[model samples]
Target: MLTIPSLHAALAMAVAVAMFTAFASNRFRVEIISLMTIGAIALLLYLFPLPGTNPKDGLALAFGGFGHTALITICALMVMGRGLVVTGALEPAARALGSIWRINNSLGLLVTLLLAMFASMVVNDTPVLVLLIPIMVSLAHGGAMPASKTLIPLNAAILIGGMATTIGTSTNLLVVSIAADLGMAELPIFHFTPIVLMAAVICLPYIWLVMPRLLPDNSPEAGHEPRKFIATMRVGTESSWLEQRIDEFREKLPEGFSFLREPQTLQPGQRLAAFATADDLREAGRKLGAVTAPRWLIKRLSQDSAKAGEDLVEAEMAISADSRLVGRTLQTAGIEGVAVLGVAQAPSRGFAAPREMSAEARLAEGDILLTMGRESSLQEFAQDQALLMLDGARPLPRRRKALIAVAIMGAAVLLASLGIMPIAITSLAGAVAMFVTGCVHFDKVGRALSAKVIVLVAASIAIGRLIGDSGAATWMGASLALGMQYLIPPVVLALIMLFVTLLTNFASNATAAAVGTPIAFALAEQLGLQVEPLVLAVLFGCNLCYATPIAYQTNMLIMAEGDYKFNDYMKTGIPLVVLMIVSLSVILSITYGL
Candidate 1:
C-alpha cells in the first residue's frame, strides 16, 4: 500500500494537474502542463522520498521515460506515417475508404470504424491509423460529413482492436513478458481474442452513431466562401494574394479579411463586377478588413439556379487590400477567404503561382500580384495595383506517388515482422527512406514530431513506472482480492482485468499496462490464479483508450481533425468505455474460468 506521504504526493499532483487542465486548451499551455507533471513527479520522488526510493531516485525514475524505447518508436512511426501520406503511398487506401463514402456518410463511417479495428488487429495499430487519418479526412470531404466526426471514432476502434492479440501492440508483449517473469506461461498470440471481439462488438455502434453527434466540426465555414464584399487594394509593386485561387491563398490573408468571392472566368482585361468605388475599397482596407481575391475570382463565384439567383450580398467584413499581406508568412496570415489572404507570384514556366509564400523559390518581377477579396473588391485591388489575374492552379503535384511510398512502408513492415530487425530499427529505417526518397522531406518532419504529444507520452510512461516501482499498485490488487478471496482464480483474474480497464481511463493505456501488468502478476501470485488471464486483463485495459484523447496518439490525432472539444470525448466515450468494462469483464470471466 502507498503510505501517507506517497498518497499525499499523488493527491497534490492530481490537484495541480486538475487546475492546470481546466484552462489548458491553448496548445502551448497544455504542453507546459504535461512537462510540469513530469517535473513534479521527479521532484517529489526525489525530494519527498516516496516509499521505495529517495527524491533524486524518484526524479531519475520519472526522467528515465524520456529515453524509453516506446517514445522513440512512436515518434518514428509518426514520421513513417507522414511519409506515407506525402508520397501518396496511402492514396490507394484513402481511395478505398472514399468509395465507401460514396455509399453514404453514416455507412461510410461505420465501415471505416470496423475496417480500422480489423486492420489494427492484423497490422500494427499506429501505422494503420496513420494511413487511415488522411482517408478519414478525404471521406469527410467527399461525403460532406465533417472530418471531426469520423477520425476519433476510427482511432478509438483501432485502439480497441489492438487488444485482440498478444502481438497487436508492444504493450501486450510487455505485459506477457512481465507475467512470464512471475512464472506464468506466456499468453498465446490469439489467447484472449474472443473476449476482445466481444468488446469490439459492444463498442462499434457507439463509435459509428453517437460520436459523430458529439464531436464539433471546426472547419464548417471552410468550404462555405464568405460573403463577397466590395473592396480595393493598391497592389504594391509586388503583392502575392492577387489572382490566386480563393482557396489557395485563404490561409495567408490577414485576419478580418474574409467575405471573399469566386472567379467568373473573365478575361484578364475584362471589367469585373463593380460593387463599390476604389475609395470605398481603400477605406475598408485601412481597418484591416478584406483583401483582393487570391485565386481567380471565378472559383469563388456562385452559380445557383434554384431561385435563378447568381449572387447576393451578405454582411460579414468590410473591404481590405494586399497591404496586410505584403510582408507576412502563410502561418501568420490566418485569413479565412473573405478576401484574398496573400500575394500571387508572377507567372512562370507553364504555371502561375498563388498569392502566398512558396518554399520553392524567391520573388521576381511582373508576376501577377494575386490579391484576395470579394469578386468586385478583388478586381478593384487588381486594377488599382496594376496586377494581372492568372488562369488556373497547377501548383501542387497531381500525380500519385503511391507505389514508391507504400513500397517503403511495406519493406519496413516486412523487415520487422520477419524478424530481420526490431520495430524501432525498421521504423526508423522507413522514416529515413521517406526523407531520402522525397516522401515527406526534411523540413516537414518537425511538424510531425508534435512536441505536445512527445511530452505527454513521456509523462504518462513515467507515472506508470512510478506506480509499478512503488508498492501502490500491489496494495491496490491485494485490497481488491481481500473481499473476493473465496472466488475461483479465473473469476478473480477477470475482475482484476476489469479493474485495470477502469484505471486506464484516468491514466493512459501504456501506463495502465506498465503499472497494471505487474500488479496483475502479484494478484495471480497471491490468489493462486493462472497468470494468463491476468496478462490478458493488462492488455485489454491498455487498449481501452476510448474515454480520452490523451491516452493514445491516435486519440490526439483525431482530436483536431474531429473538431472535438474535451467534453465530447467524455460523453460519447464514457458509455462505450463502461460497456467494454462490463462486457469484457464478464466474457473473460466465463471464458478463462472466472
Candidate 2:
C-alpha cells in the first residue's frame, strides 16, 4: 500500500500543490515565489534522491530548466516581437483592426478572435500569437480595447485552433506520434478537427463576450484622457491624397477629427489644418500617406537619425514664459535637430486656418509642441530652449527596416510551421537577424523580456521534470487506472480525461501526453472499449491546458502582456476548462458510442 517510491512521488506532488498555493495566495511576488520553488525542488531532490538515482543526478535534473529549449524559444520570440514593434512592421494590420474597433468594439474583437483561431490552425500557435501580440498592444495605444481584456482570449483562441490539427502545435504532434508508436492507427491532420470545431462553437461565445468582462482593465493609462493637439498635414507630390477632393479626403479621416478650414481640392504643397491627439494625428498622416513636417526637415531628421544609428522618438515640450522663442512663428522659430509635428495652445484657443497658421502662427508661452527626433536631441533642445519636457516620450517607427523585420519573421514562421527546422532554432536565428539588421537595437532588447516571465518559466520547467522523474506522474496514472475499472464506459472516459487534464494543467503537456497515452490505450483494452476515443481524450485533455500559465508556453507568453495575476488564470480559466471537459466528454461518448 505504501512503497518507498510512492512516498517519494507523494512528496513531489505535495511540493507542486504547495507551490501552486503560494502562487495563488498573492502574498508574495511571483519572482520570489518562483525562485523559492526552484530552490525547494533542488534541495528536496538532492536531500532525498529517488531510487536508482544519485543525489548529483537529482541536482542536475532540478537545475536543468535554465537551459531548456522551451525557455530559449520563448526568449527569442520576445526579441522578434520587439523587432516588429520598433520597426512598425505590423502597423497596417493594427490600423485595419483599429478602424473596425473605432466603429464597434464587439465586432472588432469577434473578428480578431476568429482570425487568430484560423491562423493558428495552419501555422504554429506560438508564432501566430507572436505576430498578433504587438498588433493588440498597438490597438490598445490607438484607443481600442485594452490589451489585458483581449490577450488571454486571443491566446485561448489560438490554443484551441492549434488543437484542431495534428500539426497545430508540437504537443499535438507528440501526442499523435506516441499513440502511433503504441500501435494505434495514425490519425490525419483533419481527422479529429470536426470534434474540436464543434467544441469551439460552444467556447467562442464565452471567449468573445464574457471573457473580456472577467478580466480587469489593466491599461497603465487608464483614467488619464489623452490631450488633443492641432497639427498641419503637409501634402506633397507623392501623397495619395494630393489630388483627391477635400470632401473625399475628409470622408477617409477618422471619426471626431476636425478640420480648421476645408480646401476645395488637395494639391502638392498644400497644408491642411487638423485637430486631434498626437496618436490620432500620426495615424491620420499614415492613413493619407502624408507627412506633418516639411519634407526637408523630415529628410534631415531621418538622415541624422541614420548617421547616429539611433531610433527616433516623439516628445512633448511646453514653452516657458521666459522662453526666447516666444512670439516667433513655427516657420521662423528655427528649432534645429527636431521636427515639430503638432502644437497645442494654452487656454483652449480655437483652431486657425492652415494658410493663417502656416504663414503667421507665432510660438507663445505655455504652448506645447510635439517634436520628433533622437531622445538625446529632444532632451538637449528642451534644456537649451527653456522648454519643459514632458514624460512619455514614444519611439517613432523605423520604417526603413519594417519590410526586413516582416520578411525575417515570415521566414522563421514558415520554416517552423513546415517542420523544416525546430521553432527554437528558427526563432533564435530571427532574433539574431533582427539585431544584425538594426530592426531592434541591441541595447533595447532588455525592454522586450520580463523578469517575471523568465523566473516563472524556469520554475515551471523544473517542476515538470520533478513530477516526471519522481514517478509522481506514473503513480497518479496507475491510481486513476485502478479506480476506473468499476465505472461505466462513459464515466470511465470522463475520468481518464479529467485525470489527464489535471496532470496537463499542473505538469507539462508533454509529460501528460507521454504518461496518459499508454495508460489510456491499456485502459481501453482492459475495459473492452474503443482505444481511439480514449487516446483522443488524452490528446484533448492535454490541450485543456487552460487552468495554469505553466501548462503551456502560449499561456506564459500572455502572462506579462496581460498583467495577469495567478488568480486571474484560476478565475477565468477554470470555468472554460470545466465547460470544455464536459462538452468534450459528451461528444466523445456519442461519437465513439461509449
Candidate 3:
C-alpha cells in the first residue's frame, strides 16, 4: 500500500531479522532454518508492496533458495564425505597416525592435531576429521588424556586446514566464485594457500600447548581418575564383613574411594574383581582389591585365544552421558559371557583421578573404555556396551574399490579446481562413481548428508540470498562502512572476515561467502580500496567457527566422542579467532598491498 522509501527499509529489516533469528536460536534444526529464512523474507517483501516488484514475485524469489546451487553443493559434499568414511579410505591413514599417539600422550595429541590440519589442506577436512575423531577418542580412553583436550583442538586444526585451499572446503570455493562475480580477478586454486599455511603455523603452538591445559577434563573415566579399576564385589557365604552396609565400605580406605555392588553383598575376604584393560590394570589388584582371572588363568586364556588365530583387536567406546551402566562392573554383568574383552579409561596428563574405590572402579558417565575382540566381535561389543564407537579400529570394505573411490575424488577435485566443472556437479558425479563402481552402497547415500548439516547449509543459503535480494546487504554495507572506512583498510577486511567466519560456523560457509562476499564487495567499493583484501576476508571468515560446538558438523561429531562442554570450545577457540584475525590481516595487507 505504501510507495515510501521506508517500505524498502522495513522489508530489508524484516529479512535481516529472520536470518539473525535463525542464527541466534538453536531450537530449530538447521535444515528448517533454510526454509524459514527463505519463506519469511519472501512474505515480507511481498506484503510490504514494494514499488517495482509485486509481493507474488517476491514470494517466489525468496523461496527459490531451496533449489539454490549453494544448497546442492553442501549436500553433495556431505555425501562424498560420507562415502569416504563408510568405505574406509581414511582408516589406513588413521592407523598410521594412531601409532604416533601410542608413543606418548602429549606428543600423540600434537601429532593428531597436526595431521588433522594437514590432511584437511590436501583433501577435504570433514571426512579426514571424521576419521580422526573416533581414533582420538579411542586414544583418549587408552592413553589417559581427556577427550575434551583432543576434540576441540582437532576440529580447530581441521578448520584451519580447510581455509588453506579453495577445494578444501565448499565455502572456500563459494567465496572465490562470489568474489569473481563482485568484479575481482579469478582466484587461482592455491591463491590463498600460503597465507593460510602461515597463519596455521603461527597458531600451532597455541593449539598444542595451551588448548589442552585450559580445557577441563570432564570424562573422569580417562586416566586422570585416581581410581583406576572398575571392579565387581561378591559376598562370601562365610565372611566377616558380609552384612556391612554401603556406608561403612564408603568410609574405609582413602577418601574418594567408592565400592559399587548391590547393598549388603560386599563382605570381607570375599572374591572381588575389577575390569581394566592393559592400560589401566596398574591399580587393579592393589587399589581395587580385585582380581583378574588369577593371572595364571588369563595367561592360559590368552594363549588359547591366540592359538585360535584371533588376537583381539581393541575397539574403544565412550560412556554415554546419563547412562544406566555407569555404576556396573564387567563380572557382575557377566562380562565373559556378554563378551566384554577388556576395559580402560581415556587419557589426560593433568587431569585429576576420581577418588572412588578402584575395585568398585565403577563406570561414571563419559568414561572411555578399551574392549578387545576380533573386528567383527568388537562391533558387537560396542553395540552391547551402549558405548559410543571411536575410530581407527574398524574393518575396511571392498579394498578393491578403494582405488576407485580415490580416483573419483581426485578427478572431481581436478575438474572443479581447474575450472572445467561446477563443484556441485563434480561432487555429485563423484558420489555416483563411488556407488556405481561399488565404493559405497545404493541404500545409504543419506548417511553422507547428516540431517543437521544439510539443514544448516540450506537455511543459511536461503538467508544469504534473502539478505542480498532484499537490499539488506547494501544497507548493512553502508552502515559497516561508516565506522570502517577510516580505519586501516586491512583491519577492516580482517574484522569483516572474522564476522563472516562466525556466521559461517553457525550456518554454512556457502551462506557466509554468498552473503558476506557482496557486503564486502559493496563496502570495498565505498572505501575506494582494492577488493582483494575484502574478498579474502570473506573467504577467511567463513572458516573461523571455533567459539561454539554447534558452529560446525565436525564439532557435533566430537561432542559424543570427546565428552566436551560448550565452554571447552570457547576457551580454546576465542584466542584462536583473535589470532586468525590479526594473522589474516597482516598477511592480506602485505600480499594485496592494502
State which candidate has the highest TM-score: 2
Q: In model 1, which regions exceed 4 Å deviation?
A: 1-34, 44-60, 121-152, 165-195, 201-401, 415-421, 435-440, 488-494, 548-568, 586-594
lDDT values, one for every candidate:
0.58, 0.78, 0.66
Regarding TM-score, does 2 or 3 come out ahead?
2
lDDT of 1: 0.58
- 399-490, model 3: which lDDT tens digit per residue? 44566777787788788778898767897788777777756666557666666555555555555555565566777777888888689977
- How many steric overlaps are in each model, in order? 56, 0, 32
Error of 3 at 188 (Å): 3.8
How do these models rank on TM-score, best leading? 2, 3, 1
The ten-residue window of minimal lDDT in model 1 covers: 305-314
Give the CA lDDT, 0 to 100, for residue 155 in model 3. Answer: 85
Model 1, span 1-594: residue lDDT tens: 323435744544453345234323334454576677778777766666766566677777778767776667667766766665554454455556665677687877777777777767645677788777755664554455777767777777887777786556656655664455456775555667777888777777777888778777766665742222233332322333445555665443333343333353322332222233222343234322333343344245322211222121212222223445334443464444334323324345456545323312233443323333334444454455434455422112112445767777778767766667766678788878877766665755885676865776676566656665655556666766676578865456556666666655654455457667777766776677766666776777777766766656667767776677778777777777777767776777777665
Q: What is the C-alpha RMSD of each candidate to the true structure, in Å?
A: 13.8, 5.6, 12.8
List runs of model 3 lying over 4 Å from the truth.
Answer: 1-6, 49-51, 180-186, 222-396, 501-511
RMSD of 1: 13.8
Question: Given candidate 3, what's the lDDT at residue 246?
Answer: 49
lDDT of 3 at 101: 70
